[model samples]
Target: MIAPADHLTPDALERAQRHLVAKAIAEFAHERLISPERRDDGGWRLTVPLGDAEYLFDAVRAELDHWIVDEDSIRRLVRGTATDLDAQQLILELQPQLGLSDELLPLYLEEIASTLAGSMFKIAQGGPTADALADADADFQTVEAAMTEGHPGFVANNGRIGFGVSDHAAFAPEAGRPFRLVWTAARRSSSHLALGAGIDEEQLLSGELSAAERDRFATRLRDLGEDPADFHLLPVHPWQWENRVAITFAPDLARRDLVLIGESEDEYRAQQSVRTMFNTSHPHRHYVKTALAVQNMGFLRGLSPAYMRVTPAINDWVAELAAGDDTLRDAGFRVLRERASIGYTGDVYHRTAEPSAHRKMLAALWRESPVPLVSGSQRLATLASLLHRDGEGRSVVGALVRASGIPAAEWVRSALRAYLRPVVHCLLAHDLAFMPHGENLILILDEHVPTGVFMKDIGEEVALLSARTLPEDVRRIVSPVDDEEKALAIFTDVFDGVLRHLAGILHVDGVLPEIEFWRLVAETVDEHAAEHPHLDSLVDLRADSFAHSCLNRLQLRNTLRMVDLADQSSSLMYAGRLENPIGRARIPQPAARETVGG
Candidate 1:
């Protein structure tokens, strides 16, 4: 006879059987869907269906297979009234076909029977209740008895379900709500309990818990017979659990807000420094300005005293401009007066001599000056000095007339009248030859007393003839040849070297109009060549052109480099003086000779 219902009561055993049944059904359905077969005619076939139809059929098949005995085995086990054990044995015999062996037969049968009974109970009572079947009570009791035979520590809460642990105090919640019970079952002396929904895992793991709280939670979990490691909880917002845990526990997360609010004073200052450095002409100027501004703003910003010492150098051409050099001054003034006397005010007269009255006026200013006047040679030696000085450094009308270089005294007066009318015209028109500084030697002549006009500079004349107007081969040749060669050499040297140097110092990159600066230098040498054609013939004009071209390129490159250096130094000064004290001190010192030359 089958075992009576009075024999079963364990909940744990019942739950375990039910779990196994669900798993087995899932496995069976999966295998059926994947299994390949052959028909009697030797045609290959797979019974798997597509979509919802496949799932429905597979689930139904799995249920039937779990509950009913196969046709072949029914006769052996059903002699008279079949006992539960006899039924089980018959089920065991079919186990191998189902991929289950003798050792697994008991567990497999129990699981299948539990699932079927539970489903039937749920369906018969209502639609789909979670309540267990009343008919399976005896079966559950039998399974519980059998489970206890293999293990003594087990406790049954109900049916065939069970659990065991060393202690019951380990089920405490670290934070948030207590764990909610999902299911319960029992088998003999053991019980199984599944719980979910509790504290967040992040909150539990965060090291903010105090010593007492940590120990208390640990002890309580042990009492409840659960492993703390096995349970995972959700994380809680930091603000939600304040005093429960220290804020420092999550250093990375905690710093996010603080970092957002923190000021970047150092970075702000650095950017300002960089802006100031680039803004000024010289980097140091920016620094000095910044320092002064900072002090005015009541800050103790540092500034170097050496930066304050770079002033414009005194001009050295002042003495030559004085009337005390009377002969030279008179000659310059005479030339100006002759130009004024002529009707040549604008751009007419190309050649001339210096005048007197203009020279004396300029010379008087230079003689009284404490500092030397700054000027190019064209302005200083020829125009300023010649207008003012005489042979004994005394002014005289006769001497001025003679020095004007005209054969007749009347011509000097005419030139002066011609020259005076053009000063305003030249200044307004930017005429290259009739320039404001008298770099051009234009003379205008009139019928009577000549008005002294633009005074030409003798130094510029010398530079033009000597340095800028020399032939290339003459320039390349070593000094002190024959008189003719000497003259060519001197012209080349002065025109190429001295005049060009002055041009560079004055930043006269494109000032002259009649000739290119270097071409003017070549032309000066050519002028002297008329006296000695042989010396001129010795020069290779083609070679000289190429050489001057190279020199021009070199000079241009050097000028650009100097400009860049000036810009960079200005930037550095603005940023601040050198950090190193000794280096800062040395910044004002003259640059090393090699570096300056390079």
Candidate 2:
């Protein structure tokens, strides 16, 4: 048995705390929740206005006002004396400036410690060095499990609030353990199953389970004096079954409305998004994403049965859109459709709970895997891998660039063309936008060079801004945003949330300069605009600046539900304005190349 406290030594905890503190300082400062004054030694100093605590660090400001802090240079001082770098203490000292309410202070501190603990766990694991991960032999799932950073913008990105240390060791993505899922059979009357354009129950099940496995489940139901035909089978996270379902749904289990089935024969590894699991036993099989009641990031990570009802239809529509578009097809952009879903609704909670986590506990969806999409010598890596920095502080992207045997600028241009151009076209032509952050994208690489991208998380994150007509079942994706905020679908989500960090990584690693990075991005957008000049006015990419949508502020304001799914625009929190790097690159500067190269 693995000891949970083995990684909790003072050295590991201190290192993790320092790394998290650096991230908090950088992200909080970017969100304008804290101000760090520049010191004469080319460093930065942040002092609490209401307390005697102060912090000193060195960081370089990059595009979109990103703070590339040197984690080793961070130091904390209180009353003219040095103090241990504590992430929880940092939050407490900055509570007044953070605008955290009296009720939220304690919970926020807990999240901070949880994040720090996760960091400590990763440090203890010491899975792989950056160069080792970038080697040609590193497989797809290996990179996925080896990821250290959860999300680029969020400080408490790994706060799995409900998970104990043992649960963390078994289920967390960083744990990299393959485990089987618990299957349960819910009465057909109380459950719903939805399939995509060309899927059926038998066909989905045949691919998911072998004939013997299905027979085992059916025989188990028969032995319990229940007919298999009267129920639907759903796979659930093992932790949720032991902790939540067995205790909360005891009456349903007693009444035989929900029968406990056997575990899956195939094993799956957890993705960075904790609830989703990739089938390692059969790599070509569909990915299973189950409803996890655990609290992570800002909200309870639950899958609503209502959303499951329409998820496949929404995915089918998006798939059709991608297939029909010429530019998207030529760029080799693909959408991993949520082909099928099964949701179980327990009668007691469905009637009493008012659209909270209780109503969303027992649902799961199957997404397409990128394994079967590649052929020949092609390779697959999560887009998040490009942003990964190993324990030795070497970036995987730098290793990838070296392996590609291409100049850094040219390689970056290829990546932008493969990833960014398609996203731009989707927005300008169809007024369609998605949460295209790194974790949601799968990059198809040709020996370390990105040639295409596969976008997942379709049904949940897609936002359709056009007045285009849609099927009744697919209307759940028709999210209406204000005309002014429409551009933010690209600016805020892509540039600030994704590319800003990519640029910083490359710049910090000494691979590509920041100015050249944004210039290439602007060039890609310009080329797309030139092709369809009429659509250029739809999303004005040449704007001077855009609203600084603060992600950390959303969580700070309310950790329960950061944004309403039905109306996401209303919950946006903004600081001042962020100077658009693309707009800055568009200006006529003949000497800009010389400056970056020099």
Query: Best candidate, TM-score-wise?
Result: 2
On residues 360-476, what C-alpha lDDT tens digit does candidate 1 reach at each position?
100000001101222222111111111221212222223333444554324322432233223211211211111223223322212212433333321111111122223331221
Give stretches of model 2 more than 4 Å off: 1-3, 584-598
For each candidate, what is the lDDT? 0.22, 0.89
Per-residue lDDT of model 2, residues 1-598, tens digit only: 6555788889999889888999999999999898899999989999976668789989999878799888899888888898889888888888888888889888888888888888889999997878877887788888998999899999988888999999999999999999999999999999999999888999999999999999999999999888999999888999889988888788888898888989999999999999999999999999999988888888898899999999999999999999999999999999999999988886588887366688788899999998998898888889999899999889999999999899999899999999999998998888899999989999998978899999999999998986667899988778766655888988999999989999999997889999899989888987887677576445677788899999999988887678887788889999999998877444542222334556
Pairs clashing in candidate 2?
none
Query: Residue 371 in model 2: shift from native, Å?
Result: 0.7
